[model samples]
Target: MKIKLLFFFIVTLISLSANAQTEVADQPAGLEGLISSRTAQRKNPDAKMDGYHILIIFDENRSKAEAIRNKFIAEFSNKYDADVIWDEPNFKVYVGVFKTKLEAQELLNLVKDNYPTAILVKDKLKFPKI
Candidate 1:
């Protein structure tokens, strides 16, 4: 009778441990699903599309252009919440998608201090649909 009780206790402990582990394992899938769904929503442009737009043109031949681009990204990433992208033939950096030209111009003035040669241009920004 004592041996039978010990065996039953071991089995109960193992079953309880297995159930606890399953509950913990189940948590990450829900969190991962939430993250993946949010990412999918962001990929849907129709879900959210409205912001400032600005273009920055850099000297393609200048070696310092890359350094300048990095600096601009570091400095403005949080302050202005800008997006910097590299377009072929030139390192094209763009800030927010402003509703009006004036708003873009204002941001240009703020960023130009760091990048003296940076100038504003008109070009449509493109990002791969996620």
Candidate 2:
């Protein structure tokens, strides 16, 4: 019985040791560049990404822009994120953070009749909410 238990313990230890070994694969050539780029991006929290947004209102009056933004928010509910940005003389109402123009165009098509002047504008956009 003592010999049998010792044999079982030895076999278990050998199996565990064998299973502990890990195989390493060669990293891709571009992996270092990608890692460095990601590290740089992480270091800059305010770094903006180039993307598209649907421009709903571009008016010189702040009140009018706010009114339009309110109307859009009421209509769309919580379906999108809307913002009223002041750019010098004009206050702009931009909607959605889209990675591609096609995505912005899709929303624009749905919004076109309500806002005839709505158009896709290429700009620095916020990251989409998780």
Candidate 3:
């Protein structure tokens, strides 16, 4: 009876250890498969630009332009999430690539209020290679 009890205890410990090992081994494979699937989805180039693009112009002088750029960044950073591009002759600040012209117009209105000098220009605005 003593030998039987010892064997039973050893068998139970071994089964528990095996179960724990299986669980540990399965977790990483599951995570890796998920990661690989997500990577594959991102690798597909079916993504298209279905959004609106706006062009903005700001004065590009040494003192005034710097101040305007700083002010625009501080003010619209959270509001419109603008992407500012500084050209040599002028400081051009472009806002979001909105999904609709109305969205761009809304941002233009806001910009007009903040920077009254700002103008809504054509989307064909170009920036020199930086």
Q: Which portions of model 3 show Cα errors greater than 4 Å?
A: 1-56, 121-130
Give each model a TM-score: 0.42, 0.73, 0.43
For model 3, what is the C-alpha lDDT against the true structure?
0.62
What tens digits encode model 2's per-residue C-alpha lDDT throughout 23-106? 888899999999999878756767678899999979999999999998998999968888999999899999888988898899
| Whole-model lDDT values for every prediction | 0.61, 0.88, 0.62
Q: Mind giving the per-residue lDDT tens digits that candidate 3 earns over 71-110?
A: 7778766555455566777766666556567877787787
TM-score of 1: 0.42
As for TM-score, the candidate ahead, 1 or 3, is 3
Order the candidates by TM-score, highest first — what do you get?
A: 2, 3, 1
Tell me the alpha-carbon RMSD of every candidate.
11.1, 4.3, 9.6
Candidates, ranked, lDDT? 2, 3, 1
